[model samples]
Target: MEFQGARNFSIESPGNDVFSSKYDDDGHVKRTGTWVTASAHIVTAVIGSGVLSLAWAVAQLGWIVGPTILTVFSAITLVTSFMLSDCYRYPDPVHGSRNPRYMEMVKNVLGGIQCQLCGWAQYIILFGTSIGYTITASISMVAIKRSNCFHKHGHEAKCHAANYPFMIIFAVVEILISQIPDFHELSGLSILAAIMSFGYATIGVGLSIAKIAEGGNHATSLTGVIVGEDVTSQQKLWNTFQAIGNIAFAYGFSMVIVEIQASYLSYPILYYSTQDTLKSSPPENQAMKKATATGISITTLFYMLCGLLGYEAFGNKAPGNFLTGFGFYEPYWLVDIGNVFIVIHLVGAYQVFSQPIFTLVEGWCAKRWPESNFMAKEYHVRIPLVGTYRVNAFRVIWRTLYVILTSVVAILLPFFNSIVGLLGAVSFWPLTVYFPTEMYLVRAKVPKFSVIWIGVKLLSGFCLIVTLVAAAGSIEGIITDLKTYDPFN
Candidate 1:
């Protein structure tokens, strides 16, 4: 369908002149994305490394609180996502100018120092997520090798593997994928990553079911791991906080929702030939809300399955990452396959989270030095099978260094659960709850001191407390891990 104000332009036209007619009303390349592609992108970003930790989260919270917390977080995520989606366009959700990035939306809607705060929260979360994904990817890679070794030898075999080498390998892969340009070019990769996410998640659920059917009993209770027997009182409190953080991490795709909603491909000229008779595509906010609902529904289902079934199968002993943590070892091949899917999904996910940061830095540099060819120049290199490729010196160097830096960080502190918890705790309140709620209040013109306003503020306040406790727990856990851990060993 053609956009309402879209102009018909010949596709053969060359140079910048084509941009005026070929682009959308906001000067972006025409957005061809529907709710389906949007949902794919959401699923790819949301159902990632965080899902692997849900089993452990559940083990800490126990069966009742575990499922309840997961459901509550899912509901919170859905509400906040809908709020953020509406903010994609400015004054009017339907007709206002587009705010393609999250910070852009914050700047336009909230303005002032709020934008700077949003930038720090958003970019730090994105950067930390890249590191977390790197750590998780290397873990999965090591899991595959160890799984094979266990099958060849026995469960008693050491089968030890170093995560550093695999981390470097994963970083190299990300450095290559990082050059893909922007969110507009990530549709295919996101779709593939979404599928891979489902693959491993399904494998994890299936293995959990198999293990449960085997009828072996495990230690379990309504209150989770016993404080006196399994852990100390302080440890219990800390673990509960970390569990909350893990759940928070699993539901955090809100930061990128604006970017995903803004992603659009150019429509073919043939289809737009009869522009007068064509209808505009569905409004972006509407599409994003639908995608959020669908994606969250699908992910929450998998999360419940993975977390609940995994808990039932392994009880309080559930590993942080059920698949790679060797919770299911007999079907070693299936475990290996699951790890492979994790690696592939993370490769795509790393790009999804990193692209916005790349855009922000690169955009800032270009604006700062418009005359610098080193920052703005594009070198075209054509391979036989592939079409012409645009290579920028600054992009190549900056993104490569960024990947390397994250890789080194992952190597230095390779605690997966703690890192995920810390990132989630740091980002969840500000990015997920507070920003969206405040933005919605301003954009929707919610009356001051009204019931809705008070309720949202209360929600935000409660989440702030959660963030504090979760951050504390994650930090404590990291400190504990570091005591026995040797960096880069």
Candidate 2:
């Protein structure tokens, strides 16, 4: 369904005053990020190591269907992002109030039960995502080390891809980085992450071009593009929908949009910025639409290039990960460099995605234990212009423990592609399809069961069915994979 940017309408409820947005003194928009920064944030948050799997995902669909799936999902995500953007404004202009958190927005529209469920799902999905990043980072380090060893010893190199040491190292680094107070604080990192994403995409594309030039056309056409005789009907069906799920996962960033927008607006109108800032000098709607469009378009191009090239290069034999599949070429420095870029990019991305969870959990804790020391304000050291943040001992302890836990889980499971698929299945419908559409309907007061409303419901139901099937397949795949690898190996 097409969502218009101009149709943003406010909703008023008597007890909605509890929702608030934060602002700076003098009420100017305190955290107004430039379009460049917002674009960077979107790129960093959306394009994780997930793109490394796109070639394999599309390989399941062949050249014809693969690109179609990528383009279709990209448009869907862009439309949902617009639906979400409209909700960032205040429900009541006079109160100048806004819901800065996704959970808050869900609570405002769908009521408390759904809001609680959304909060749970959001944190779980984000945490699962962080685990996927940790696995990717660890595996990338392993690939780099293997490449370096092979360069020195040729066929005699005995390189192992162990998860524990690198997982520990990655976890420690993430623990240090995840301590950043807010999204705006991590803008510089986001920019670097964007650059790193581009670096990896370039490497993937360049290598694919080189491989094709070398006549590396050793691929079986199991994807039903050229001929359907190579595989059974069941195999084709499974791979086709599996490919759809992977594409959906690749575009699953809707849950984090509200948090990213928070960086642009500082806080919503309720917290600090005035209604004048919202009505008069606020960031232009078109500017944000452009930013969102530019970021997603660039990402879609990169994903398609990597998917098409990798599929054409390796065909049905394409490895689950594009970079890992490159291991057949010995002593390739480009492979090492690309893997390093992946590690760096995932590190930055882990923060971009995890910070929202941190914000929501901390806010929940502060409210739940108002009288406890866990909620008490304390002093933190200054970081230049950031000034001394009012630190809480609980924050340092809890967020650290949380990172450690996710790291441990990654080390234990280390099921990279499967975990990503699972998380994507869980998030795609609620965060991407259902919640945004439902909330928009609520905000716009479109009558229930009308043509538009029934159409939305039917669409949402279809999405949920597809995702459920996807989740089941992903779970089964993980079970099969688990039999092949022991924990921490």
- The positional error of residue 205 in candidate 1, measured at the CA in angstroms, is 0.9
Task: Give lDDT per model, in order.
Answer: 0.81, 0.71
Residue-wise lDDT of candidate 2 within 38-138, one digit each (tens)?
56656655666778888888777876777887887888788877767666554532233455567777888789999988877877877888888898888
Clashing pairs in 1: 31-264, 32-265
In model 2, which residue pairs have backbone atoms overlapping below 3 Å? 21-271, 22-271, 97-270
- The global Cα lDDT (0 to 1) of model 2 is 0.71
Residue 139, model 1: Cα distance from true site in angstroms = 0.5
Best by lDDT: 1
> Which residue ranges in model 1 land beyond 4 Å of their true spot?
1-41, 94-98, 179-188, 261-291, 378-390
Q: Please report, as a residue range, the 10-residue window in candidate 1 with the lowest summed lDDT.
A: 268-277
Q: Candidate 2: minimum summed lDDT over ten consecutive residues — where?
A: 268-277
User: Compared with the true structure, what per-residue lDDT tens digits does model 1 show for residues 14-111?
Assistant: 55466655566543466566678777656655666778899899999997899999998889888998898788777898878666667777899999
